[model samples]
Target: MTTHSPHPVRPGHGLTVADAMDPCDYQIADDSTVDQADNILRSAHIDYLVVRDHNGRCEGLVTRTGLHPFLTGSWYTERTAVSTTTHQRGPFAWPSMGLSLAAIAMRVKRLAVWPVVDDDGYLLGVLTASRAAGVLDAVTTP
Candidate 1:
């Protein structure tokens, strides 16, 4: 059996990752307190935070929904465990990937966002559902 790589998106379509992605820097160290993560998320007004390990490599993602139960209605505290609040590592994509296809896949998987990492797993940025929607809208709007 044989498999082949998918073709890259070309320029004529007016579809590209940069068209949808915003350069972002919301990250929290894995060992950091839940309070720290919450502060970053809230202050940035973003729904998710890229979790980084001690060496500052992308580890996983922490979302508002994942942290809500711990941060509300009585369990709220500065010392809540970041470990327990994280949604462990999931799929990631490369930066050059086309926005529309990536967005569709993420939506199908129910992922609000996904990380874009280099070959060495260094964090580049993210492809968010909102951004993807914008990309779809821009392409389909004509």
Candidate 2:
């Protein structure tokens, strides 16, 4: 996953998280039912969903693994909140963060999806590993 920038794109050369992040359509209300969250996850074909609070602020993230318990047997009939499935509260990135730095942070955090948020903790989008790799490819390729 090593990428050598083609030009002189230094650490703070202006390439940022916003440049590589995609619109976060995979978001669910914190109070949403597990079934509803599961439906969105299935429809979006994403690994996880960002759980937002009433103010549309990022509360945490819910992965499919977290919802597994509720998806099977009698639990499926019960009302489970998406927030209950969320474990990671943050390590969120700012839009102005340098892309390469953000990529490194993502690696260190072992995160496949990095939520990009504003100062107020509102989720702007997600910077997926694939997307970051794509940007690196574009920058490093001849």
Candidate 3:
């Protein structure tokens, strides 16, 4: 599903990235296997995973494409190790951030997925490229 912006995002809409970020949809534990991550991505139909540690703190993110090397090669059996080493850190946005700023950060960082965190760094949800585009479309549409 896509989120529609209420109106055209203007220079002074005062809307923050948190306002546009989708609810938390993807989640996985630190110890979860690569296969498990892959299954979640397939089932959820999303490309990112919000990795949490034992205390449920945000650790990082792992993408579907990032697991390809470990899933299809002579080192396929090395899934566990690959997952442990390749966990990518999730980028963050505060609730007060502007949509324009968030969009710029995503683009400049080449991030397909970014996470929303609270003051304590608690994982709130994710902001994906596709979802962001949807918001843009909604806001720009009459």
lDDT of each: 0.76, 0.83, 0.75
> Any runs in candidate 1 off by more than 4 Å, and if so which?
1-19, 72-81
Give, for candidate 2, the lowest lDDT window spanning 10 residues.
Answer: 5-14
> What is the per-residue lDDT of model 3 for residues 20-113, given as tens digits with 9 covering 90 to 100?
7888767888878888888889988987788887788788788887887778767666347323747568557877877777877888888877
- As for candidate 2, its clashing pairs are none
1-142 per-residue lDDT for model 2 (tens digits): 9998788754435689999999977788888889998898888788888889999999878888878877875745658777766456786999999888898888888888888999999999889878887897687777
Candidate 3: clashing residue pairs, number = 0
Give the per-residue lDDT of model 1 (tens digit) for 1-142.
Answer: 9977598644325565655666657888777778788888888898888888777778889988887777775857677667667475855766777777788788888887788877778788788888888767766666
- Which ranges of candidate 3 are over 4 A from the true structure? 1-13, 78-85, 133-142
Report the alpha-carbon TM-score of model 2 versus the true structure.
Answer: 0.81
- Relative to the true structure, candidate 1 reaches a TM of 0.74
Q: Give candidate 2's total backbone clashes.
A: 0
Q: Using lDDT as the measure, which candidate wins?
A: 2
